[model samples]
Target: MSYLELEGLHLAYGNAPAVENLNLQAGEGELISLLGPSGCGKTTTMRAIAGLLAPRAGHIRLAGQDITQLPANRRDIGLVFQSYALFPHLTAFENVAFGLRLRRVPDASLRERVNEALRVVGLTEFAQRLPANMSGGQQQRVALARAFVIQPRLLLLDEPLSNLDAKLRVEMRSELRRLQRELGVTMLYVTHDQEEALALSDRIIVMRAGKIEQQGTPEDVYARPRTPFVADFMGWDNLLPAAQAPAAARARAPQATHFAWRPDAVNVGLGEHTGQVLARNYLGEYQEYLLGTPFGHIKAYAPVGAQWPEGHSVSFDLPAERAAPLMET
Candidate 1:
């Protein structure tokens, strides 16, 4: 059986449904991420799993027990919010120990559990420090430790690294992945950042408008997006209407309204299709070109060394094999 399951789950804000007919499953020691833009129902789904928002209909099961109607505290699920939500009055050690203490763990066992949790997040020395005194990354670690310390049935992280600076967010996400592996805990992560979701998840559920748009391994979804919305969400910027696309590309996805390809897939300097470079952005490893094509603006990426200046006429190929077909219907 799946270690965690959400069956026919529905969530609503009074009359309006925020999430409808959602079903998901996660195996033991697996990390799954719910990814989408704001108002896509990812956060609402997480909140339901965490028992912060009671579902309007359906069941939630963790390790075979039905927890659909359980209160947040009694569900044995740990949640770390984007804000960290640490107590200012409590020291890091005390914060991690709070749940264990509430469960009436003896003093000796409480110290061991709290200390071990701190050690897991590499926060041993700063156990006595206050949240205000720590860096954003450090504060996140504390939050992680606090959540994991409880030894819950599942761990839920809601944009846990969103508050950190770019560099720190990268740093903490790497650490979070490492810690999850070491602990062998089932984790449900929620994020709007596609790259972060791809980097951290064992599997990803792409949510949209209160439903599951797509769910797969990182590679599966990125390389073969099933719809125009999914393709656009995965960073495929140039989507040609099937009629406007090359004949070979159009033939590959006869059912799709739009035939798309990644910018990196566009072979510059050679092909039947031509465009005028409207702009060029030099990323360290690649050059991004916004080209004016017959259909519209097409975004393509080439190696940085192949510089194409503005107003430059560029020949590109959209190979039929690499086309990602998208049908709105």
Candidate 2:
């Protein structure tokens, strides 16, 4: 049996169902991400597991024990919300030691554990600082340290880095992954960001309207998306109308309707197939090229310095094997 299992879990707010018949399982120490757009029940699922909301139906089990009937306080799960949710009056050390204090742990042991957690998140130097005194990234690290200090059986993160700026989000992502690896704690992360999910998860569950559309490893989900929704949601923006795609791609893909490719998957260069460069936006390491192809307005990327003048003609090819087949039927 899996260490954590949600079998046919359902939750509703009064008459309307927020989540329906959801099922998932995670092995011990596995990092799983629930990824989907807004209102897709990613957060709803996490709330159920955390005991914040009681599911109207189905079961939630942890470590082979039935936790479905347990209250939130008894579940032994750690949660970090999108907002830092730090106590405004407490110093970093007190905030991290809050959970330990609740259990009436000895002062000496609480201090030791709190300091250890701070060190793990590289926040020991900021122990005396309050949330207002720290940078966004530092505050987030303090929140993470607080969650870990409890040493819960499972960890739940609901867009924990969303509060940070883009640059700090990237930095915190690395730190979060490093801490998760060192602890080997079972985790369920909820996010709408595909790139973040892909970068951090051991497995991904793509949800839509409270149901799982697909679940797989990063490579499996990206390289072999099973539906048009999956393809578009994963940010595979280059959608090729069937008639204009390579003959082989059209034939092998189901229903012969549509094909999709990642911008990086299509090569923009001199080749037999021609494209008109409608626009080019230069990024630091690379450039995004908007090209009008026979398939439609397809987006292709070229490395920096590989520029084509506006309205200039360029050749490109979407390789047959790498072209992701779309289930448009």
Candidate 3:
């Protein structure tokens, strides 16, 4: 059985159902991300898992033990909120030790465990620093150390890295992955950032309006999205309305009755049709093109050197196999 399971979970605030018939499974030590936009129920689902909100129906299990009725204190789950939730008055070490102290662990053992947890997060050197003295990324690390100090059976992280700048967010991704692997704790992460989800999760649960839109490995979700929403959400930019693409386009595309192709997937200067480049953005690694095509404004991406100026004509071909079909429903 999965280590953490939420089966047929449903939740409603007053008369409005926020989540319905929701089911999820996380294997022991596996990291799964609940990914979606704001108001998509990802945060609500995380709250339910953390025992902040009781499900209107369904059960939650951890390591084969039913925790559906377990109160937040007894659930033995540690949650790291997006806000870090670190006490400004407490030093980093004190913050990490707060939970152990609350549980009245022996002084010697608590000190040892707290040191070990801080070390795992690479924050041992900053143990004496207050939240006000540390950078956003460092505080996030402290929050993580605090959560893991309890050695909870399950860990819930709600957009734990969203507060950091882009450069720091990238740097912390590797750090988070490393610590999670070292600890071997099951984690349920919730985030709206698609790139972060792809980089950090073993599997991703794509939710929409309180329901699971699709669930799979990063490659599966990116390369073979099961729905239009999934494809669009994952950054597939060349969306074609079902009735707009050429009849030949439909016959050639394989994944959906209606489909989209990634910009980089189209072969420029080698295909059956030619389009005029209406605009271009020169990213360092690649160039993005907006082409005026019969199908509308088609987007294409190519290597940095493989770009043409606006008003230049470019020939591009969509291989039948490269286009993805959208889910009919």
Candidate 4:
């Protein structure tokens, strides 16, 4: 059996369904991300797995034991919130040692474990400092240490880095990945950021309207989305109905209802199709162009040196080989 399993899971808030008939299996030490927009049930699923929210139906099994009805404290699960839920008055040491204290672990043993957890998160020097004195990144490490110190069976992180600035978030992604790998802990990470999911997950589960739209490795989901919703989320900016696409593009997937490709796939300055550049923006590494074409408005990227002003005509192609065939829009 998988290390963690959710079978026929149903979650709701009163009359409103949050997740319906959801099923998932996660292997030991695997870092799986539940990715979607707000209200897509990713956070709700995390809450259910953490035993904070009761499932309207279905079972949750962890490490061969049924935990669907277990109390939150009794279930060996640790949760880190986006807010970094630390007590302002408590020092980092106390915050990380809180769970051990609650369990009545002896003073000597709890001290060793708490110190180790803080050291693992690279916050050993800040142990005597209160949360208010620490930087955002340091406070976040305190929360992680608190969760890790418990040595739980599973860890649930709900947008843990969302509160950080872009640079810190990127840094934490590496830190989080390193911790998960070194500890070999199974984790269910919840996030609305597609890039974060792509960067960190062993597998990505895209959720929509309380159900899974798609689930696969980051490469598979990004390169070959099965539906328009997923294609759009995965950064496929140029989507066209199969009938509206060029003959060559449509020929690549005769049965597809639609086709999608990223801006990078729209090769500019060397194709049979022509379009007027409606607008252009320098995007650091490449120039993005909005082109008004016969088919529709298309977004494409070209090399930084390839500058085409607004109103200029440029030739581009939606190469058939680069298109992702979609069965549904």
Candidate 5:
């Protein structure tokens, strides 16, 4: 049986629906991500799971026990939020030990568990520092340690690393993945950032406005999107109706109404079609080109060394093999 399950979950605020008929399952130790745009019900689903919001209808089962109506404190779930939510006055050790103190754990055991949690997150030296004294990454680790110290049945992280800078975010992603694996905790991570989800999740659940658009491994969802919305979200910059697609793409997926491909998939420098480079951006490893093509304004990525000036003509190919067949436009 799945370690966590949400069956026919219906959630709303007042008369407005936030999530509808949502069914999801997570096996023990799996890191599942709820990925979508803001207000797309990803956060709403997390809130429901954490018992922050009372579901309008449906059942939530965790470790074989129905917890639909369980109080947030009684749910045995730990939450780490985007803000870190660390108390300003509390030291790192105290913050991490707060939950244990609430549960009335003995002082000696609490000290051992808190220290281990801090060590696991690589924050042992900073245990006495206040939140105000720590860097964003260190504070995040403290929040994580706080959550991990309890060893809850499940962990919910709502955009926990969103506050960090690009470099720090990447570093923290690695740290979060390491800790999750080391501890083997079932986690429900909520984020709108595609790259973050792709980097961290064992499986990703792409949500639309109150419903699931797609759910799959990062490879499947990134390479073979089933719908135009999913294709766009997954970085498929070239999305064309089958009727307007190149002959090769149309021939490859005859039944598909829409076809999609990532910017990197477009072969540049030598191909059948020619396009005027409308804009070129040097993105370190690759050059992103906005090209005015026969089909439309298609985006393509070329080698950084292959500089194409604006208004220059370039040969490109939309390879059939690289195209993702989409049933919906």
Candidate 6:
């Protein structure tokens, strides 16, 4: 059995259901992400797992033990939220040692554990500093340390890095992934950022309308979307009709009724297909183009130096091998 399992899980707020018939599993030491937009039940599911929200139906199991009805404090799970939630009056050392103190750990052992937790997050030097004295990233590190100090069975992070700047968010992604691997802890991360999910997770569960739309590796979900919702949400810019689909994609998916292509798959210049550039944006490393094509306005990207301005006529193509066949729902 997988180390963490949610079977037939149903969550609700009063009469309105937030999640229904949801089932997922994670292997030991694996880091999985619950990915979706706001109100998609990703946060609700995380709450249920952390015992903060009770499930209306189904079961939750961890390490072969049923924790479905357990109260939050008894679940032995660590939770990190978008907000650092650190106590302003407490020093970094005290905050990280709070849980251990609650467990009535020996003074010597508590000190050892808290110091190690800080060291793991590279925050040992800030141990005596109050959260008010630290930067956002440093405060977040302290929160992580606090969660890990207790050595919980599983870690639940709900957009924990969202508060940081874009650059720091990327840095924290690497930090969190490295920490998870080094600690060999099971983690369930919740996030709306597609890049963050793709970068940090060993597996991803894409949720929509309070249910699992698709669950798979990042590559599988991105390249071989099984449903229209997933194909569209996973960044397929051009979803063409059957007749317009490239022939190669059709051969790979004989029964497919449509085709989808990522923005990068459409070559922006010199091709059998042509389109007028309706709009464009210069991203840091590449350029994005909104092209008015027969396929109903395709989005395409070119390397940084490609400078086709808006209103420019450019040739492009939906390469046969680059398009993915989409099956009918």
Each candidate's TM vs. the true structure? 0.97, 0.92, 0.95, 0.98, 0.97, 0.94
Please write out the lDDT profile of model 6 over residues 1-329, one tens digit for every residue: 89999999999999999999999999999999998888999999999999989899999999999999888999999999999999999999999999999999999999999988999999878999999999999999999999988999999999999999999999999999999998999999999998999999999999999989889999989888877778888899688867766666677777878888899998988788789999998888899999998778899889988888889899988887887777656
Pairs that collide, model 5: none
Candidate 3 positional error at 203, Å: 0.5
lDDT of each: 0.90, 0.90, 0.89, 0.94, 0.94, 0.91
Task: For candidate 3, list the clashing residue pairs, or say none.
Answer: 255-325, 256-325, 256-326
RMSD over all Cα atoms, model 3: 1.6
Candidate 1 lDDT over residue span 1-329, tens digit each: 99999999999999999999999999999999999989999889988888889998999999999999888889999999989899999999999999898999999999999999999999999999999999989888998999999898899999998888899888888899999999999999999999998899999999999999999999877888988878889998888888898889877668879888899888887888899999999888889999888768888889888888999899888888888988875
Off by over 4 Å in 3: 246-249, 252-255
> Candidate 1 vs candidate 4: which has greater lDDT?
4
TM-score of 1: 0.97
Which 10-residue span in candidate 3 carries the lowest summed lDDT? 248-257
How would you encode candidate 2's per-residue C-alpha lDDT over 1-329 as one tens digit per residue?
89999999999889989899999999999999999999999988999999999999999999989999999999999999999999999999999999999989899999999999999999889999989999988898888888988899999999999988998888888788889999989999999999999999999999988899899998888788877788999878987767777887776765746788898888899556899999999978799999988878878889988979889999998887778877652
Q: What is the lDDT of residue 91 in candidate 6?
A: 99
Q: On residues 70-128, what C-alpha lDDT tens digit does candidate 3 reach at each position?
A: 89999899999889999999999999999999999999999999999989988889999
lDDT of prediction 5: 0.94
Q: Give the Å error, residue 282, model 3.
A: 0.6
- How does residue 238 of candidate 3 score in lDDT? 82
Candidate 5 clash total?
Answer: 0
**Over all chains combined, what TM-score does candidate 4 have?**
0.98
Clashes of 1: 0
